[model samples]
Target chain A: MKSFNKKEFRHGLKRGLPIAMGYLPVSFTFGLMAVSGGLPIWMAVFISLSNLTSAGQFAGTNLILMGAGFLEITMTTFIINIRYMLMSLSLTQRLDKAMSLPKRMMVAFGVTDEIFSVASMEQGTLTFSFLIGLIIGPLIGWTSGTFLGALICTSLPESLSSAMGIALYAMFIAIIIPPAKKSRPVTIIILLCVGITGILKYLPLFRAISSGFRVIIASILGAGMGAWLFPIDQDVEKNNKQEGVNQCN
Target chain B: MQLERAFLAMILMALVTYIPRVLPIVIFRKEIKSKYIKSFLQYVPFAVLSSLTFPDIFSSTGNLTSAICGTLVALWLSYREKSLVVVAISAIVTVYLTGLFL
Candidate 1:
């Protein structure tokens, strides 16, 4: 209870509201997919509650439904969700130095792609309460969407479910657009990475590669290229940190 | 038997995913000093998300037109800085309407 910081908590909850809305249609589709694949509604909700990573959960569910080997499930999930490591690292760079170890671990559980993107753009050093508030919206939305999706998939028409499929990608594109326009390096990195992914996806040899590995390799290469060409100025970093500390006070 | 396997798979999936997210935050509590690593992290989201969005976005729905139109609308809205909820729901509606005609 003492952990609650009302102002930051309110801020985070507000921030999370949009993310929660975005997660609804996407996770609704995930629920439909899950129940069709033979998961019980509760189990689908359980997965949504426990594993917030969308791509990882989809792959893991596919395997589990197939009765794939545990080693396979683990290995597949590791490959798919490995990008979160990079995201977490980036967010750690963005976090307040005073944010504690226990707090870091707690928020780490909620580090989905959308959450990380939104949090990384925060202007100030993060407080645990704000972080919890941020995590809570998506957590509830994802779980409830799953429950509703599983419950209603049998009842919904095919066209409706299919239309919902595009919501996640639409949200991702929405997230990147502002930053892409604001930063030249980001624009170039996005173009280069999308091109690389296209090559990997379409070319005969690389088409066989799993999308998980493709994302990992493409992401690292894109970031590496951006780093090589357009490193963030140290003056800027210091300035941002100064602003963050000032905001903290 | 199947349920047990699914349960185990869920647990394992949770563990592996959790480790990746937790490890980096716990290991790097101090301020990062390296410019290269910092830059890499800075650009990771754009690059990863760019790759994630491509090709996949174009084909997520049944018809190409629905995906393409919805994506175009989303790009336009988000560029104008619409709320994410607005952007996503608008695109969803766009696709739904497009689906009716297609």
Candidate 2:
């Protein structure tokens, strides 16, 4: 058991290093933004530590600055984060049959896109030790970046800071565009959601829903529509066929 | 202190953030058994990413010119399946240069 734990830890460290490298610049931007928005270093670090969510933290911070109510913050965060539920649900199929409940719970908490991508790609039964490496590795990188960013924001000029802010959006594009290009349905879903959200921001009815509700309603509706149209059975068959080729190899 | 409210706000924000993250894990211990629910989960990422990406692409500079330049650069790079580092650096450089020019 100890040896297994060590192996898993080592594997996780290897997988997480690349992801941490990607996160550093992005989290640095988050930290810089937080400081520029008047947040303290400690608070900025705390946000990175607890939330560990880039988009949600950015949106939440802006809403707070806007003096948005708790309901608004809650709704916005929920909307932004609802994607994790999907990640978690898909991940369960990949977990070890004998995986303990507590470990699964802990692993679920660390389910970001990068982490999910890495973990999902792993072969064999998922273990708590593996999950720990996954969680802690990125956590260290993300928190340190934010902390350093907060400390150095004052020294950096506005132009440079603004440039760094684009990192998060860049990361999002990297994630969405690849899969979208491969699948017409995926592209449609993305365009549909963007169109609906754009309309909501401009339309009076959606304007009344608050930014938080706007995100939530748009996400739920978009996901619901996509699911109704493109069932997962098709994907499963596609994956199975691909898996067969791998097995033959 | 200038930092006090931001600190308080951060703590409140953290607590709010933890609830959403932790609740599903604690409550939904079993796999979601419903097929429809599973299908819904699959599409959420596309929707969320789109919603997040579009507004920022257009509004980051509060000007039409920078937004257009950045979006065009991003679209071109993405269409070619270029590495993210290349796409990001090109877009940022484009925006920064545009800002300097205008």
Candidate 3:
């Protein structure tokens, strides 16, 4: 019910720019895949508009293409997207405690991996406007990229588009490394995650686990291990303490 | 009929996906009090991002060499505390340029 905060929203938009750019190629590929798989162009675009997810949309659309049943599609999407629960829970820690339920719901819709990473690592309490601003650019990029890909059907050269694949991961690196530099705990946790994930991916014994499950196992083990090995000092964890008192009237 | 089925499937997918994302934030309005749990949540971002990056990032671009090249550039720029756009753009360009050679 409050007036929108233009400044924070602008900052969110600026921060979201890279994420938007990163989504372009991925969503573009999604559009191309869905349409080429025989879904109508509107359907492909609708999926991007409604879903705003990468892996889940891809998996779901793939199932749809194969004429998989609704329950099967639903469950597969859920498993692939279960990681968002951790992300949303983690993000709740950073959000302003006073944020209203509707506002919380709005921001929750935007909790993609890239958005969560950028917002989570952000320096302080996140305002609703800032979160909205952060989400809009990437949302537009994702939908528009889907539209373009579905419409054009691969005009960009393969090399250029394929190179864009690293953009989001690159953005992920940009989010984590700075914090890792300042905190030994952060550095250790990151290495722990990388090592575990690498093993899960490459080990023949664990080869049966899907990539989505690999992320979940690695994240839980890595964070759980960090919590045990390097319990943070309570005082140093006051990043959200000030905002706890700043509830809106 | 197929259109109706696909639409229904998408709606179902959206509902299931939204549930995981929305439930925790809505349910846990009160801040958690446990230190251990708080620490776990705190470390979640780093853990998730790192996990998402490794192995996957190595296979992100055209090939391993280009991906490595892009990853190193991203690491170097971000180590110096470059802005996200700068770091991202630099890495993309790095990958693109590296792709040219291969």
Candidate 4:
């Protein structure tokens, strides 16, 4: 607290502008989906305000719209969000180890894929001040975009609205393609993950399960298969976490 | 008006999402030295994001053609390392224009 570095804090905020801007269209779509899916405007905004997760919010909102069981919603969201654990854990490595518990708690709340990716890429240890600055812009942007999307979506024409829905997925693809092109491991893993997801989506045997569970099963099994096929040493994690986490994690 | 039900779902979802994000940051106060665990964590983001993107994207826009075209545009731009906003808006434009044809 006493050692607050304004420069790094400003640096974090400056770096965060892109993330905040990127979040607008994606969260806007989330708002559209939540409202169009029959949620109240306040509820849609509440989900974005509280959850701050893209896939988890989408899957959970669908479950809510469908009157899905509580267990189903919980399990689906937990599965969807499990990756953030990894992101936060990896972030711990770059953090200023002496960072206070209160600051740790605050910064952890902002560790989205995009924030973690950018913060991880920063040279040298990360400070709490910089993290707060980084978190503020994207946090404000995500919540506000959700609000904007919720308010704006109701007036849009159907075709335009439907077209805008693809933006999030487009962002998702934008995230993975670059790394998949550069490395053998990333390539194999992306294909494997996508294949498993496809099977869950298309296969008759899995028709009884909901899409949320399917995503859960697909991601877990796919990651497991990827880990088996391409196990990384500690160095891989240490070395690679910083090199690139751009586009969506 | 299932506002109450939606509220319940939101709270549950928030808690579930919150735990995964906070637990690792709070509990792991020290560096994680376990190689197997580190390896698993390393691939989690990629595995999760990739799975979420495919097949799911196809259904998002309600029109397969527009979705595919948008995804292609997005991939091309991101591969070239365009900013996320540029990539997203351009892909959206691709979807919108293709949407017109469809």
Best by TM-score: 1
In the range A1-249, model 4's lDDT, one tens digit per residue, is 457899888988998887888788778878877787888788888898888877788888888988899898898888767778778887887778788777788888887877776676566788998998898888888888888888876657777777777776666666667666665677787788888888877889878876656766776677677677777775665455445443333
Of the pair 3 and 4, which is ahead by DockQ? 4
lDDT of each: 0.85, 0.69, 0.85, 0.77
The residue pairs found clashing in candidate 1 are none
Q: Name every residue pair that clashes in candidate 3.
A: none
Better of 1 and 3 by TM-score: 1
What's the TM for model 4? 0.86
- Candidate 2, residues B1-102, lDDT tens digits: the string is 345655666666666555555566555657666767776765676677677677656776455687678777877777676655666777778777776777
Can you write out model 4's per-residue Cα lDDT over B71-102, one digit (the tens) per residue?
A: 88888897888766778788778888998887
lDDT of 1 by residue, A1-249 (tens): 355689999999999998999999888888988998998888999998888879999988988888789999999999999999999988887666777788889999998888988887777677788889999999999999989889987757767777888888888888888767666777899999999999999999898889998988999999999999988777875564344311210
**DockQ, candidate 2, vs. native dimer:** 0.43
- Segments in model 3 whose C-alpha atoms lie over 4 Å from true places: A1-3, A239-249
Rank ordering of all candidates by DockQ, starting from the highest: 1, 4, 3, 2
Q: Whose DockQ is greatest here?
A: 1
Q: For residues B1-102, could you state the per-residue lDDT of candidate 3 as single tens digits?
A: 299999999899889889999999899777778888888887887888898889899888869999999999999998887877788788889999999999
- Clash numbers, per candidate: 0, 0, 0, 0
Provide the global lDDT of candidate 1 against the true structure: 0.85
Model 4 chain A — which ten-residue stretch has the worst lDDT? A240-249
Candidate 1 chain A, poorest ten consecutive residues by summed lDDT: A240-249
Candidates in order, TM-scores: namely 0.94, 0.80, 0.90, 0.86
